[model samples]
Target: MPDKDAGTPRVFLVRHGETEWTISGRYTGRSDIPLTPDGEHQVSSSAGVIVGPGRIIDPSKITHLFISPRTRARRTYELLFDESAQKMIEGKSETTEDIREWEYGAYEGLLTAHIRAARKERGLDKERPWNIWVDGCEEGESADEVSNRLDSIIAKIREIQGPYMHGEKGADVVLIAHGHILRAFAKRWIGFPLSTSLPMMLEPGAVGVLSYEHHKVDEPAFLLGVNMGGSR
Candidate 1:
């Protein structure tokens, strides 16, 4: 396949692999759940395909690694890279609270059905229903709150990618975090409102790419698809 955006800086949004809560459809926020055995396998398999030279996410080309301060995300990082790649990542990685999962608060660890039922009992969603994008959790981070922090991260990334987007090499940034926040990050990356439902899905252990159109930092956009061929 031809290189569509060759030498352009990119942002890789990686969602942590499956966990107990993920299987149960629970809202895993501040809770630090470990990845299941299958989760580890999932990320490792993904690494084989994407984390190599000339692949979608070449570890040596990664300039910055912003990871969530959660156990699952941390472990996912470990599984996503081999010893050599991890060595390449040194001095470029930061474990930050800014990329942590959305603070679920009252709804933490609760399934969506249960959360809505509880809210109904409390007479909270009479007009419509509890929607995280609009209603937010009773005590959790609002959509605006999530957007604010993600904006900060995006600003930092744009600064890092500024001089490199123009055909310069080795400036890809990677973010390892949970479902909702990564989706929110993508939305905010393109200056979209969080209330605008994300039509794209970032599955566990799946990777999403964001980059500039025409190799211009001012033209940030989602890299909708890439064909990961057999090996690097």
Candidate 2:
């Protein structure tokens, strides 16, 4: 476990750009989907605005990057960082399964409406609506399971930032992953349960910041006013 110190170390959560399933609002889990042309362009254009010298994610200060193994996520990672930053991140980055999208299982590739209709037909939750945070997906990961996995990763991140807290001025970590998992990660980062946290909307190519309030690691909080900088 890392020591909770008064330092401004931050974590940047980057959701992958658009994909076929993403555009269609289909549940994409273990399936490896590539980003669409627009997705690539969106991420590519965001690099300068979000990751340059004075940007939210200072490329030079990035200590480590955790990227998802999925194609869309990896591609998004490549597009988000420029060549110089890529070189700096080469040895510090690793592809981890912990950051992959939520496993949709039987609900994979099904749109939200279709899943709801199927659930209604199957006599599941006839009165109430389906919520992934509570109901989760049939034969898939529960919200608690997702929270646990993200907690493990967050612990690792804290461990990595421990030494840098006292020594360096900037020790930033970056995570490039899918929408649901990243949103869940942000909630867990702030020690909030999925059911309790407000619903967060993370568009493709959008970025979110997670850091400590008052520079205390024990006081984790999400940074607000994170503009995507330009049209996506």
Candidate 3:
């Protein structure tokens, strides 16, 4: 394998900016709510910090974009990359349902506390409180189902990034989606089961990087910490 950091391909996971549901702590799956005014500002401000040249996620380094079909995600992409930057990667970008938010089903638009209360009222989770990772949503996707979905995406991403492990260029990929789905994708990226309870969190409008250890494609890993004093 090449040097640990040489030309290693990376996946940048971006959770969409805040929505009313996000602030309210509601499950926002497939509801299609727009970002709040603060959300728009948040994404725009983030772009200025991380999406510029020599910043954390330079637009020029983005080889491909896999964006969720949700309006909030698409709008995040719009505000994230300026018109010039968008034009730069327009041909390589794709809007995909594969990366959409986790389906919440009956739990949609309900807060976690309320979901647990409802489940308790219905005699569910008496063994323990409701846990999305382990118990999943009623009438929605199970942990295994979500794992299967994300595993397929990881396969496609690896295919695109495998060739670049040896310092090849143009292999940085970006995924724009929701909080739970992106966190789930990170777990699946590292071969962890959805019920593993890794305690990972991706804040709205924040960016996280997934890459391989020692420039080896088979050794998938993620940056636990980074110092951004200079060029990314």
Candidate 4:
């Protein structure tokens, strides 16, 4: 909570560790699945290396954390920060529905290939592939709705970090959530449409950084190809 030197404020997007559905490639929206044993180990190993001083995420610099309401995301957050660091953020974390996985609705437990095959059988998309960005889920959220919610979250983040950006140090906001929502959040973070030509992918137990270029809040960009390290 202490203000530091002025710098470009950053938002760290962390995709939750592996779950049964994640390994099987099923749509896991709104499901309260727990992390696998390997998944737990993956995140626990990352905590010490990537979250301390002179690391990708300095624990002291994280002002706030937004976590999804799902068990997977919450468990990932717990495994990614050790006991003392968790104590420091005891009152700083908020579990939010906004940060939850993209609602899969009718397609909740279905895999992508299964959904596509079902669509073809039902005469939905027989010619081309079913793209989530374009086709979306049968009864779930649309691209526009997802974009709107993420934009609102981004605005709230700026509201908290705006004052610190111009000072000597910047604030850091961390988000612990699912794969699709995190990617969509990053896409909207840089003012890009959900159907950007360049796609972004995040592995289980991975971290991605989003910040402004040239220290200007208006110039948002992703820190591409820069390995934060200690993530699997």
Candidate 5:
């Protein structure tokens, strides 16, 4: 199902900037970790890219700016957008359980290297031996589980396109969320199943733009761009 001319929402998805856990390569799932100084600077610098004299972003066109309730995401929204912009999209800027990072559960707080080392000792050496997205969630969700959850969230966004794209002329929507979840969101957006999230490595502090063209019901959504680099 494609979005009707009711509106075409341009979503600028931002993975929350870095944190101490990220720098340390720890699995900070479900943990309330604050941004490191570098993290804060990364997001703050994006503010200049999106706004200001150069003003890459057309402020007047932006409407709904969404964010996870996590401090890291919320802080990014605050820094990237202004107070009034936040107010305009407060309700839409919601904390979605689906938008939350993949629940690492028992693996939380462990580094990839450490996990792999432990796994190697136990003969768990494989690309996705412990990949929660495929196997069962180790004390958490399977990849299918995470995919289904994110599907519902994307559905909600599509359902609210009218108000989300609400603007004097048009609107640009923003979502500040975690890396893994956002990657899953991308997978779902292209009509791929949950397992498709395997290859798309959503990097931290990255900003991706999703654009589409709809002339009628004839053309679905055209994949305008994705995982675009340049501005963090």
Candidate 6:
């Protein structure tokens, strides 16, 4: 494939709007949750920050609008664009399993407090039996597990920037996905330990822009922008 980024594709990753579980701080895994009325509005209004009046980004300039196959992500994309505009990205939006949220497994949908109570009852203190980072699902993935899973997706983005986009220039890969995974994305991209993922929490409909102006991955990829305000 020809490189699409002769001049490094600027990447802007957008987390989807709110879900009922999200507002409650529950662990939402592969459980396809839909956005609430507020979430729909949030995505609609804030989306323009990327493409509309802010005009910081041009919708047509995007080479790819990668979206999780999860309903929330897809729904956000659909609602963010008007009928005609939706058609542009609807056809181009890529379904990426890697962009899916962290797997909550047995605890999926259980609020944090409830899970903590259950964990205490089970005698599974801070330490998870298996790798919580990987096996977070009922037999699903953990934080570290998900981060590694995203590796391929990240690599694919890099590949798009290189010889593919035009030769070592990254392209704009806008991802619309859930919260935990997005936080994990930021953590891993910076080569921080998965535990580090704990410190940063991304809310729904947040806009996070990660770019590597540096010559090498070892070099720090400036945050560019992190957790910008949302529609709400």
- Worst 10-residue stretch by lDDT in candidate 6? 162-171
Candidates ranked by lDDT: 1, 3, 2, 4, 6, 5
TM-score of 4: 0.91
Give candidate 3's TM-score: 0.95
Q: What lDDT does the true structure give each of the candidates?
A: 0.88, 0.83, 0.88, 0.82, 0.65, 0.66
Q: How many angstroms is residue 25 displaced in model 6 relative to the true structure, after the best TM-score fit?
A: 1.8
Taking all chains together, each candidate's TM-score versus the true structure is 0.95, 0.90, 0.95, 0.91, 0.77, 0.79
The 10-residue segment of model 1 with minimum total lDDT is 223-232
Backbone clash numbers for all candidates listed: 0, 0, 0, 5, 1, 23
List runs of model 5 lying over 4 Å from the truth.
1-7, 52-59, 87-91, 120-128, 162-171, 215-232
Which digits, one per residue and each the tens of the lDDT, describe model 2 over residues 142-231?
999888889989998888876665436568899999999998898888888887747889999988888776555677788774544421
Q: Over all chains combined, what TM-score does candidate 1 have? A: 0.95
lDDT of 4 by residue, 1-232 (tens): 5323235677899988889988999999987889999888778777766886656776667788999999989898888887877876678798999988888889998988998888888888767888898777778998888998999899999888777675454378999999999999988988888877557789999888887776677777887644455221
lDDT of 2 at 180: 91
Off by over 4 Å in 1: 1-4, 229-232
Model 1 pairs in collision: none
C-alpha positional error of residue 151 in candidate 3 after TM-score superposition, expressed in Å: 0.9
Better-scoring candidate (lDDT), 2 or 3: 3
Worst 10-residue lDDT window for candidate 5 reads 215-224
Clashing pairs in 2: none
Cα deviation at 219, candidate 5, in Å, is 6.4
